[model samples]
Target: MRPDFAASSNPDSITDSSTWEAELNLGFTQRGDKTVLVRREHRGPLTVQRPFYPEGEVCHVYLLHPPGGVVAGDHLTIVATVENDAQALITTPAAGKFYRSGGGEAQQTVNLKVAENASLEWLPQETIVYEGAQLNSSMNIDLAEHGRFIGWEILALGRPAAGEGFDSGAATLNWRISRIGRLVYMERLRLDAEAFQARWGLFGHSACGTLFVYPASSLHLAAVQELIGDEANRGVTLIEGLLICRGLDSRADLLKGFFERVWGLVRGDIVGKEVCAPRIWAT
Candidate 1:
């Protein structure tokens, strides 16, 4: 069955349309002493600002969705490839918003490719999904031998500060991580109204997140645990060198902050450098 998006003569144009279909493709390659964005392709509202090198040589980019929010019948895609020996970090200017939908599902897909001896960091801010919204999101990462990656996806289920809870609709998330063509970790989670209010589920928490770090050691897990030990709803574990961290909170900012702290603790081990906070984050 086909998705119900209206036919458009121009694939990149959203003129007079109620729904949007957008995609962005980014490629980074090492040149001389620096990593550079060599490829950037986009359609519709999805695009990126010029690459920033606040730390020098390491390319940092901010994704932009000009419409500011996604609603029913919208589809978005983001793909990034880091060539051999290159390093890049990708983030968004602010939290993404998936507004309430009347019926159809809004979809977002992300694909990340890290080549041999390369490093890529995916650290977008939290996504805010409003009440009555239907969202389906997926992220897949493929890494070659000697490649490294650290990434996280934080989600805010509803506008907690606005007294809105995700009482209706659903969001499904899927993640796949593979190395050298071998699939290692795969997961799928579906959240609906029942799960939102259930003690076994979120138990009224409005925000949740998962952070993944490749090439991690048991020591890294211990260090992260030391940061999360005081929080009852935060946890970390190591599986086949992949360190997975999870957290839940009533506010999205809190959950995002916790992940940032965890990232700061392990970034040096993962990337051989300490965290250089993105300047756009403070603005």
Candidate 2:
């Protein structure tokens, strides 16, 4: 007999849920010799993709490995810091998928900090939420003066390929981006299965992603619009050098592909890279 799969009122209370945390600190200083320092600490069983830039340069690190793949009551935390003049790019090996839990809820928290004139990219792999799963996630970022950061989060509510179309599950996401202790942008999205499937909400789509580009400039604005022109299903906004791009899709891969394109454009124009495909991303 198959087990019952239904939404529970208290998903966070399940006893079997797992927990995990990972922290990485990157520092760069010009002390007669230009060198980069990396300190990584892992407290639990999490696999990391390792940070890799072109030509094997360590721009940033990508950490993976979920404590326990999003079972009911699971909690996960990821903390990262980049010191002054440090440049890093972080990305997951693949999409982070959350399976349905029998009982409680699953939650994840991410915190990122970039010092003055430092550049950081928090481009994790996309996240897919299965039916009957309840998830709440938040991402908070702090940047200093002249700090540059690029971040992206993609969420897929259900497996549309298997005939699942967000008919189940609940997700709440909160994100805030700030620089020099000043708020730049803040937004939240709370979606239930029904609301997510509404023609107007996700417009019956199963996947969506948000890309944030900070400390916006006029050139960046024009470049972003040129890159995202007339994508009917996506939305774009500019706020204080922060470009926000949101896209809705029924296929998970579509979201990933879209993000890759956006990343390439932004990196080339803003980050001074002709090709931003990190070596680890291709691996």
Candidate 3:
């Protein structure tokens, strides 16, 4: 089988020697009832906007990737830490794009830590992977006892509305979650051309997503199930104290909307605060 996707980025891909390597690190600590960005370091094209306090002390931030899209040989790393009693919510202003690879793979990694009694929300927009793209992405999260988290990741295989499908290319996604110094959950997914079309795999869905909320309840699971009642291609479950939700669809926008609805339903239970969408989402 052959992949039916683009051969390179909108322009040509950069050679491995000339590829961009970017890294961003941020630290947040509680200061007088507010979480302040106490430490920041960025190299290359990655940076963040000033923090916003739309819902009181919760620090809301939007990560920015100035280069807009990634191609072969690009690597990005992000690390964020929230100190005890601090609270932070992070997101991206726009969807990330992984263009078709000329050769080597593009990679992105995220590391997050929440200290005891702290809260962190990782809610980036979905990622768009063009045909022939080779991407390796992973997220690692560590939470101390009593720390709370609500986050989601969405992947769009191709531009379905534009008549494109993931007929070629490769993607590997991984997630690691640890609480109280013990690993609680881990997942790995490898999707390729065959898996994209297989009935036992994506079954031709162009978009898929997962949402996780730590320290959840049966009632919360019930609430999410109640909201998703009878909806095909959507499911929810409670594992230990984590609530996990999954969705699949043909359009990325639709899947993202569905995840947003679920986020609204379960946020209060997970974070003790009602769903206050980051204002950046509006534009």
Candidate 4:
């Protein structure tokens, strides 16, 4: 299991009576050509549904947050490990909500580790940030030689369709990926409500998203490009063998659909088999 997140700069953050800190750790292993969940530990409201095998060899798990949403000073951490030759795909049943903060920030940290010849897919639903909310989110991925990973993140600044925009809030995001003990990708995004609404910045867009694929080989670059044609408010790039796809939109549904298509394509190629959406996604 991964270590807990470092203590917050404000020592009182977790000590507040209203604050809630949750943690969950999971490990997967291969059992005679079938991926199975071998370990799981949790504290607080984080948990996972029973493992399902939709593709025979791949295990599908759905992470659950029973509280359904996060409030001020809430801290959530998740860590997952996949052993050699095992494959696992994890997703959420619904969008994660970050409610308005009362001068305190909510934090979420995730770490994933994959051993040699292993494959892992981290595909959670979108995250919704309410006005006046302060959110800090980070993801760290470590992969051994020949390991593979695919993941995506979507964030909505506010409820745009409902006429609620991010008039006041702060958002910080960090993503890091390392392969065989060498860092290959790192990105950080910080947004202040005022500047984020500027034309030169987010341009009043209420939602932004990114899809990341690691270890994409030259042989698949052309195919990847063909799948992602030129589109407004969207771009695709390859950095240090990581394929990054980014987009900005007013609605989360648009970005969600876009990411799903790319996920299907990439998974098919990497796994050498067609994949279907997990049954839980429809519920």
Candidate with top lDDT is 1
Report, for every candidate in turn, its global Cα lDDT versus the true structure.
0.89, 0.70, 0.88, 0.83
Ranking by lDDT: 1, 3, 4, 2
Predicted candidate 4 versus true structure: per-residue lDDT over 162-206, tens digit per residue: 677888988899999999999998888987787567876688888
- For candidate 3, write residues 205-239 as lDDT tens digits: 99988999998999988888998999899999989
Which candidate do you rate higher for TM-score, 2 or 4? 4
Off by over 4 Å in 1: 1-17
Q: Report the candidate with higher lDDT, 1 versus 2.
A: 1
Per-residue error for 117 in candidate 4, Å, reads 0.6
The worst-scoring run of ten residues by lDDT in candidate 1 lies at 8-17
The TM-score ranking, best first, is: 3, 1, 4, 2
User: Model 1 over residues 1-283: C-alpha lDDT tens digits?
Assistant: 2222223222222222388899999999999999999999999889999999999889999999877777778899999999999999999998887777777899999999999989999999888887888899999999998899999999999777777788898999999999999998999999888998899899989898999999999899899988877879999999999999998898888888888999999899878889998998899
- The local distance difference test score of model 2 is 0.70
The candidate 3 region of ten consecutive residues with least summed lDDT is 1-10
- Candidate 4 regions exceeding 4 Å error are 1-17
TM-score of each: 0.93, 0.84, 0.94, 0.91
